[model samples]
Target: VFTLRLIHIFAIHKQLGPKIIIVERMMKDVFFFLFFLSVWLVAYGVTTQALLHPHDGRLEWIFRRVLYRPYLQIFGQIPLDEIDEARVNCSLHPLLLDSSASCPNLYANW
Candidate 1:
């Protein structure tokens, strides 16, 4: 998004000098659309991966190593009740806190 925005702003700034207002508005809308689309794609990808490989160990390995593990490290595994909610927002508190090091607690509910 940043790269594309930079290109649009710099590469075509002069070309759209007369109608830069309209271009900027359109670019903002496009940026927001792509951001939401990417988010939806990621959600769909993860859901599809889980559904397609329900019993596959590779899926677990990939999810843990690629996503959950780092998440645990950043959040610090601790029980939900034991979590310091004051330090984190309610939405993020659960992700940031889990009792198990591998984040089974986190994935269990997800």
Candidate 2:
């Protein structure tokens, strides 16, 4: 067919050949970077879950706590003010806290 021969002509074009090769190499590099990123993400998720919500029971909430929260934190959604307030509240009344606080049991100066 005429369309098939036209496609073959463009496939063997001299000017576009190098661009196609570059795109292929770029795709490989991108895949490698994605693999590396995923490994770090999983590690962060697991550590955060262990340190923050060790007794969590629900499956959906566990996923959100581990993966979703850390991913958003990476983009600057950290709750520094809340953490400071919680630390203050914990210091003032360490045994009178409710269920809505987020005080990690890591270190005193954390």
Q: Write the per-residue lDDT of candidate 1 for residues 1-110, one digit (tens) a residue.
A: 99677656765567655476677689899999989865765565466445433433444454644445334534566335424334423222334334322222223333
lDDT of 2 at 99: 37
Measured by lDDT, the strongest candidate is 2
Native-to-model Cα distance after best TM-score fit, residue 28 in candidate 2, in Å:
0.8
Task: Please report, as a residue range, the 10-residue window in candidate 1 with the lowest summed lDDT.
Answer: 99-108
lDDT of 1 at 104: 29
Per-residue accuracy of model 2 over 1-110 as CA lDDT, tens digit each: 99666655666889876676677689999999989987888788878777754544457756776778777887889746435644443322335333344344444222
Candidate 2, residue 13: lDDT: 82
Q: What's the distance in Å from true for residue 9, model 1?
A: 12
lDDT of each: 0.49, 0.64
Q: Model 2's lDDT to the true fold?
A: 0.64
